[model samples]
Target: MTHKIAVTSAFGVESVTKKELKNLGVRDPKAIDGSFVFDGTMRDVSRLNVFLRTGDRVHLVLKEFPARSFDELFDGVKSVPFSDYLPTDARIIVNGKSVKSTLYSLSDCQKIIKKAILSRLSEDKRTTYFPESGPTYEVLFSIRNDLVTLSLNTSGKGLHKRGYRDLVGDAPIKETLAAALVALSPIDAERPFVDPFCGSGTLLIEAATAAMHIAPGISRDFDFLHWNFFDKKLYEETIEEAKSGEKKQKLPFAGYDVDPSAIKLALRHAERAGIREYVHLQARDVKDLSHAKSHGCIVTNPPYGERLLTEREALELYKTFGDVCKRLDQWSINVITSAKGFERAFGKKADRNRKLFNANKECRFYQYDRL
Candidate 1:
């Protein structure tokens, strides 16, 4: 059955909408605030679990309604044909969000719905166990102005957990965001891509993976694996297809850092992910990244003075960063930073700027296109 599935994306970031869905073979995708809505089957869910790289989570929104009180919430949940989805002993968890609604406490709202579901199941099906011992349904409640929107989390764990990076350095960029940045940036595998301050090799790995058409979830497992409706034959078919689809492509991407320990971790992670052959690792300073190429792209998340160094050292780093970009005049540059006066220190105006949150810190994506 074709169903309306809502994919949870990074809040306030629109770059991962249609492109991400397309990468996962999801057709006719619609972009929504902090989410993407699409139509697919249980088999497609298996593909998403293995291939999607930019979304935080993927949810299947069951229903939305106006509920002013606890009774209304109960009625709304019981309205759905839960007998078809939830087994007699299935566990249930409620994760919710509220904005300007009569439902003040999330716990209270969850308890009421649970009671209603238990009552309906026990009375109609004569099932005593409220939560059976199989899969789980994480229902989300979004209450706004006395209205409730309930949805089931298909992807139990966040998509960012690609299950490859066993080692991460200080101030590591999320794999999802790194992949999104690579997709939105001007970097192409035809030339070379460099991340001078690439901690944990996220940007480089994402670039190499994109170039080779390797499935992001190749070594990862997801929550949908434990769902009652999950089909093993269909899931295995998807995995085999993904494996067959991978092709050898040129990925001249490299990562460099001053910390040898960080470089060691990145190398180990790439080895574990089975993509070390496609990436080159080095321990070097940002100042050494001068004039690598004129037509490629230079992207990095440099030291932001958080746990690395002082404000003065960060400023000097930015100054040197400006020099590197200026020297490599033919390369388009895209940087993600939270440093104050970044553009000013770089001595160049960005062609485009996008505001996004990195680890809850407001940051910007500064882009410079060499025209």
Candidate 2:
């Protein structure tokens, strides 16, 4: 059966996510508010959940309609064939969000949707008391301008939860944003890749995964795995196909943090990410950050704001790091930060910059090329 699918992502990374979907052979893929939406098969669903690096979640769009009234909402939701997607005893969890709609009560919307789904399933199962002993089915509904869009989550967790990094530093970047930062740059997979302010080595781990053609969700468990209509054999075959394309070898990447504890965590995290011996993790200050190789790349998330360092100290570190990077004239320097007056403090303007959101804070990804 064909399903309307949505590969959701964070803000300002639509282009990167779109290119990734297109490369996976999704034709004429369209982005709607930072999400890739398309009508695809179960294979497409399984393949995307297993390979997307920047996507947040893979959702099956069940239905969409206008519902300004409670009756309209109930009727619209009840019209869908819940039994087709969910089993007789499926445990249903409904989540709702209402924005600029007449039915603004999120709790009311969730309850009504759940009631409607149960009513729909009762007719097919011919029972009133559903044991709910079967697999899980997470339903999500969003109402914006009186329009309700309903979907089921196929991914069990956010794609950023790559099952690595048991610990974190005071300030850590999300894996999704880390991979997006690496994707926005031009880096040679064989050359040296470095992160100076590597809190827990997320950037280096994600970078190594990308450079080596590693499937981000190769070992992840998805919600679709427990669904009745899902093709289990097809999913297994898809994983095998993905495994065949992997480029498994030692990767060239490095991460350095001034805090020795952070370095210890980076080492453990790298081991969890299956890249322990392949990459370098060390305790070193930004002043001592250097690489002997030319044509390398520097992708880092420096200390910014009041989390790890004060504003004044962050600016001073940027200036000092800028002077240090000047020596690597043939390398590329990319920094993501919420620091104020970053370009001016760095004593050099970035060749280009892009807006990105990190931890719900407005940040800029400043890209400077010395090559």
Candidate 3:
């Protein structure tokens, strides 16, 4: 059955729209605040769980109502056929939020939902222990004024945990944001892509996965599989199908970092992700970066001193990094930084600049197209 599915995107990543949907095999997606609303069947949901790397969570927008009070909220919750989606004995928890409404208490909201679910089951609330066997249905209730939006959390643990980053240091880019960076970049992975300061190799990995159409969820487990409606057979089949559909390709992706330990960790992670054969990792300074001779891209988040270096040192690195871009004039460069006066440091005005949030600090996505 085709149902309304809500996809939660990273903040400042509203740019993920139908283009990404089509890329991820969805027909059309409607972009909303920090999310995209799309229609999909249960199988499609499973496919999304396997294929999508850029989204934070995918959920079924099961119900929405005008909930004014606890009674109305209870009715709204009870109106849905919960037993159809969740087993009577399924282990469950109610997650909720209220905004600008009388139902401001999260505890009260939980009670109301619990009562509604118990009433529907009628199988003795205590006996109906939450089942640990299948996918989980995460319920989200957003109350604003008299309207309430109830959604189920379909993608568990968020999409940023792309299963590849077994080791992450301070201020690593979230996988979702990394995907966005790659998506927003002019990088054509058919050529070559490089991240010079590839700390933990997030950018390099995201690029390779995006290029190869590798499903980000392949390495991780999701909470949705705990729900009664979850079909293990279908899930396994989807993974097998996606994997079988993968085409063997040469490595057009590489990363260089001066830190030997970082390179080692990145290589291990790539191997763990089963893509080490498709990615090349080397320990080198950014200043020594050489072109792969083909037209491609350089997308990287240089150290900003907050994690890897001091303020003076980060500024110095950016200064030299800017020089390198100028020298490698044929490459499209996408640089993300939180340092001040980046344009001046880079010695050119960015063709496009996007405001993005990285680990709570506001940053900019600066793009330069080499003519």
Candidate 4:
């Protein structure tokens, strides 16, 4: 059966996630807000959970209806055949969000939805008690403009949890954001890539994996894996196909950090990410940022005086980094930071900049091309 699928991401990453979906064979997908909506089969669901790089989570849309009151909400939720997707003993967890809707109490909506599901399940099983000892199933509900959408979370944890990077720096970027930065940058298999202020090597590792055609979700488990109705064979096949697509050749990717401990952590993360050989990590200050090869790309997330350094120190570092960039000609220097007057400190106006959020911290991604 064809299912309506929704892939969500950060607000500014719609284009990246949409391109990823299109490459994965989703045709003419429509995006609303931070979600990309499309129609696909169960196999598509499995593939999306395995191959999506920039998506935050994948949801299989179960129902959509207008519900301005609690009664309407409960009835709309109870109408869906919960038995078809949830087992009698499944631990159902309801997550809810409301915006411009009459049913504004999130807790009330969750309780009602959970009760409706329980009523449906008990009626279908002819029982009043449940052990709730089975696998967990999370149901997400969103009420926007009095329209409710209920979806099953196929990705239990967010996709950014790539099962790596047990440690982080003061202001570490998410793996999803790092992948988006890599996509937006000009780094490719042919060009060298470096992250001068590398914190745990997320950017370098993401760039290496992308160049090598590795799926970020290849080795991670998804919520759908434990579902009773999921096509197990198709999921296993998807894993096999994903492994087959990975490139074995190492690329010219390097990362440096002023903190030796951060470098060590980055090395461990790269090893955990299974791309240790593809990435080189060393303890070095940004003042010494240099690459032997020309025309290489520098994509980094530097400190912005918000977490790690003082405002004066961060501005000085930006000036130093800008000076370093001037030495490396014909290369693209892309940076993401929350510091104000970044262009003034960086010594010049960026060719272009895009607004992005790093962990809800408003920031700008400045892009500079050539010397």
Candidate 5:
């Protein structure tokens, strides 16, 4: 059966998510704010969960309607055929967010939506109490301008939890955002890639996975796998397809960090990601970074003077980065940071800059083309 599907992305990477959806054969995906919506079947659901690298989560859209009151919200939620997707023993959890909506109490909206779902499902089961001992179904709601959109979460944990990083450094970039940054850059198999401040190696790992066409979700389990409506064989076939598509050749990629602990953790993560042999991680400061490669790409999430370094130190580091960039004239540089005066500190204007959010921190991805 065909269902409306929505994939949530980081605030500024909706276009990347939509591009990925289209590449996955989703025709004309509609880009809403922070998400992409499309119509697909069970196979599409499995494929998306397995293949989407930059999305936060895949959700099955249930309904969309105007909800200005508690009564309207209740009726709107209760109108969905919950029994068709959720089993009798399934546990239900409601999460909600409201923006510019009359039904603004998020807590009240969640409680009412849960009650409505229970009320509807209990009627079908001819029981008042539902012993929810089975798998979980997370119901998500977003209200914007008095219109409520309801969906079921198909990803349990956010997609950034790729099940590889057992340890993380301070201010580690989210894997979804890292993958998005890599996608935005001009890195390919031929071009070498480097992340000088490779905190926990998220950027390098994501870059390697993308260059090799490895699915980000290949090593983890999703919420839909436990659902009653999921097609297990189809999902297995998709996994096999992803495995078969893995590129065997190792790309030229390296990561360096001043923190030895971060480098060790990055190595461990790379090992867990099954790309340890492909990624060369080392403990080196940004000032001492040097490469023999003439032309390559440097994509890194550097210190933003917020958590790890002071403003003065961050500026000094950017200056050092600027000096390093001047030496590597054949390389392109892409740095994401929350530093306000990054260009001024770096002593050069960026060829292009894009605003992105790195875990709620507003950041600018400054790109300097090869010069």
Candidate 6:
């Protein structure tokens, strides 16, 4: 049976997530706020979880209906055939959010939804209480202006936890956002890629995986793997297909950080990501960045000065970055920073700028292409 799936992403990367869905052969992916919806089979669920790079989580959309009152909300949730996807032994966890909706009590909404699901399942299993000692099925709900959308969480942990980066440095960029930064740049397998301010080396690692066409979720397991209805063999086949599609390409990628400890952590992360062989990492300041390759791409997340470094220090770093850019004018530069006067400090305006969010802080990705 075909199912409606919602793939979640960061606010600014809806388009990137949609493109990834399309690349996975999802038909007519619909872009929405913070997510993209598509229709596919259960097999597509496996494919999406295994291959999506920029997506935060994959959810199996269950139902959407208006719920202005508590009774309406309970009835709306109870109408879904949870038995089809969940077994009697399945542990159900209900999470909810309300935005500009009449049923604004989140705890009450969660309680009502949980009770409704239990009532629906009780009829099938003839049990008053579920033992709840089984695989988990996380149900999520969003109520917007009295319309409720419910879905099952197919991805357990967020996709950004790609099983690598067991340790993170200060102000580390998320793996999903790092992948988006690489996808937005003009870097490929053949082109050289560099991240001078490589805190935790997320961008370089993501770039290496992209260059090799490695599925980000290859090393991880999804919540659907524990579902009763999903075929384990199909998931295994999907993973094998992803493995087969990986190409052994020579990726000219380098990452540098001023802190030796950060470089050490980055190298360990690279090793964990299975791209240490393709990536070159060194402990060096951004001001000393130099490369023999011309027209390469430098995609980096610099220090935002929010917690680390003063505003003056961050500005000085940008000035040094400007000097580095002038020395390597042939290379394209893509920088994500929350600094207010970034362009003024960088000594030139970006050819293009995109609004992005680094975690909760609003930031801009300044792109300067080599002319």
Total backbone collisions for each predicted model = 4, 0, 14, 0, 0, 0
Local distance difference test, each candidate: 0.79, 0.88, 0.79, 0.90, 0.90, 0.90
Error of 6 at 309 (Å): 1.1
- Model 3 residue runs over 4 Å out of place are 25-28, 123-135, 292-294
- Minimal lDDT window, size 10, model 1: 11-20
What tens-digit string does per-residue lDDT give for candidate 1 at 1-371? 87678877775466564677786678877875567788888887777777887777777777789988788889998887666666777788887878899887988988887777677677778868664576777777778888787777777768777777876688998888888888878766688888899888888888888778888887776666776666788778988998898986657788999899989988987887778987789999888886455678877898887768777788789888898777788888888988877888888889998887788888888988862
Model 4 segments more than 4 A misplaced: none
- Tens digits of per-residue lDDT, candidate 6, 12-87, equal 8778888888889999988765778989988899998999999999999999999999999999999998888877
lDDT of 2 by residue, 256-350 (tens): 99999999998888888777888888999999877888778999999885687789999999988888888787889999999868998888999
Q: After superposition, how far is residue 300 of candidate 4 from its true place, in Å?
A: 0.3
TM-score of each: 0.93, 0.97, 0.92, 0.98, 0.96, 0.97
In terms of TM-score, which candidate is strongest?
4
Give the Å shift of residue 128 in candidate 3: 6.1
lDDT of 3 by residue, 126-197 (tens): 364555454455678777776877788877688788777777755678888888899898766577788998
Cα error, candidate 6, residue 246 (Å): 0.9
lDDT of 3: 0.79
Q: List the residue pairs that clash in candidate 6.
A: none
Candidate 6 similarity to native, TM-score:
0.97
**What is candidate 5's lDDT per residue for 1-371, written digit by digit as tens?**
88999988888788888889889999978878778888998898889888999989999999999999999999999999898888878888889799998999999999999999988888877777678899999999999999999999998899988999877688889999999999999999877899999989999999998999889999898889999788799999999999999994677899999999999999999999999997789999888988888889999999889898899999999999888877788899999998998999888888999999988998999998875
Q: Return the clash pairs for model 1, or none.
A: 89-131, 89-132, 90-132, 294-330
Quote the lDDT for 78 in model 6. Answer: 91
Which has the better TM-score: candidate 1, or candidate 2? 2
Candidate 2 root-mean-square deviation in Å = 1.2
